[model samples]
Target: MSSIHSVTPTFDEQVPFAAIKERIVQAMCAASLGAVLLFGAGFASMETLHNAAHDSRHSAGFPCH
Candidate 1:
């Protein structure tokens, strides 16, 4: 005969709220920075700046075409 032991973790053990909040904040900041850079290029009025972003999107498989 064999005996088996089973254990389950509590809700708090499954996920930490602080870590999730930190990750969300970091993601938001990164997205905001990218958005700023994306829009800021328009104000610079440089063709290269605009094309660089366009090309990067295509390379990333964003289907810009």
Candidate 2:
């Protein structure tokens, strides 16, 4: 009878490359979205921006009147 041997993977080989790539893509997308929102709000009219921020604050139960 022949005996079979099992092999264990190292730390670097444990995680798949596809998972790492996905995480990087997600982080980059989030950063890009934040930049766009910040610049867009900065260039928006004062009244419109204030109203939108005010509504958001109230919806979140934060008083800023």
In model 2, state the lDDT of residue 58.
97
lDDT of 2 by residue, 1-65 (tens): 99998998667756789999999999999999999999999899999998998999999999996
The all-Cα superposition gives candidate 1 an RMSD in Å to the true structure of: 5.3
lDDT of each: 0.85, 0.93
Misplaced by over 4 Å in model 1 are 1-12, 47-65
For all predictions, the C-alpha RMSD in Å is 5.3, 6.6
lDDT of 1 by residue, 9-28 (tens): 67766567999999999999
Model 1, residue 13: displacement in angstroms? 3.7
- Which number leads on lDDT? 2
Pairs clashing within candidate 1: none
Winner by TM-score: 2
Off by over 4 Å in 2: 1-12
Candidate 1 lDDT score at position 64: 69
TM-score on alpha carbons, each prediction:
0.50, 0.67
Model 1 local distance difference test score: 0.85
